[model samples]
Target: MDRRSRPKRHEESRENSRRNPTTRTIRREAIRLEDVWVAYAGSGKPAIREINLFFPLGKLVLITGPNGAGKTTLLETCLGLLKPYRGKAFLLGVDTKSRKILEARRKCSYVPQDFMKPPYESYTARQAIELGLVLENTPDKNTRVEWAAKLLGIEDLLDRPLGTLSGGQQQRVYLARALARKPLVMLLDEPFSSLDRETRKTVAEILRNYVDRENTTVIIVSHDTAPIIELADTTIWMNEGKVVKVEAK
Candidate 1:
């Protein structure tokens, strides 16, 4: 493979780099799944159990499991939407369970598993994506929105109401919003579950380019593996609420 064309699985593991990076000095741990288990408060069993996973910044990791394996719960925990009953979930090196952790979440973005544009979020695709920048008061809001729209190949739908878009189109717009922050980390759940293989591949290639160059960490949850099997740097297999297998690609 052409060195420049390949993605860096780990910064230190690189054959060469523009600058040397160290484990201790990473900007922040994008994600850490340390003995983490999440259960709805009062529930007996955790949705996922003992997930000891570490994802470095700038790489893409894929999560695979059958339905009810707790894939959505894992993504929710990473986004701080769910608190683990046992173990810890960290975002950008800070424990996300803290009340003050909203700041930590600001550096993260998510395209939820449900993939629906919420009620008030029925804005046009561009409007929804722009809201991400508006909430952050980003300096170049228009430029950022345009970039995300173009990157996702949804520039044509920029003015279309999200409700009118097809499932695939809506998914792309959801991705636009999640990526609007140029976030340090992104959590996407079943992003391609509905798309055909060719379209899925195209989207995957676009995301791969973004993460590889911008050093963004992307953790995607999906039961489908045919498209992303080769692109992921790490793959975690969930079974009955536990990570039964982990393979480094």
Candidate 2:
């Protein structure tokens, strides 16, 4: 390199140094499961058994398991969607299956594996987010709606009909609707099932920042390991409905 270019390179190096943080700090515990077990109403075998886990607050967690291995069952139990056959699920420091289930869900958001809405009804991306806030009876619904749309980069499609949007656009809108509540935790089921590789990476990157900035906990269920491993702080691998916890380096 020439002497004249050295100064410019030095300045660029300084800019990068100023932008990087060498250390990461953690502040709280987000999800804690203790000796939990879940079984279907009519099934003889348990879906998830003797599970124990502690997740750092604001951390992104990836959950991977085979079909029928209880990945869905675990998310449902944590969000108080299912009644546990035995043991406990402590989410946000409260028993998830107790009377507080409704309240617990208020601060939690979920996106199912598939997106299905009633036929013949028209909903714009913005309207769908608005409806979610209304369903939760959240105050400042408009602000929440605006923020959710913008955060997911769907503000440009606010007036576009949900059915008219592209697959990636539709997924982002679904994400915005879940984010409308400004929940403390987000549970996603098979988020990458239908997305292409680029969309998968983009969505994963956005989720990583969201978890960090909001101190929000995210637990995502996916069989695709690449995106999950790239974004997760820790991974919980399940087989036959049992979790194998490990810190990924």
**How high is the CA lDDT of each candidate model?**
0.81, 0.78
For model 1, the run of ten residues with the poorest summed lDDT: 16-25
- Per-model TM-score on C-alpha atoms: 0.85, 0.81
For model 1, the superposed segments whose C-alpha errors exceed 4 Å read 1-26, 117-122
In model 1, the clashing pairs are none
Q: What's the TM for model 2? A: 0.81
Misplaced by over 4 Å in model 2 are 1-27, 135-140
Residue-level lDDT of model 1, residues 3-93, one tens digit each, is 8645655554563333422222335578887899888867776788888878889989899999999999988888788888889987766
Query: Whole-model lDDT, candidate 1?
Result: 0.81
Show pairs that collide, candidate 2: none
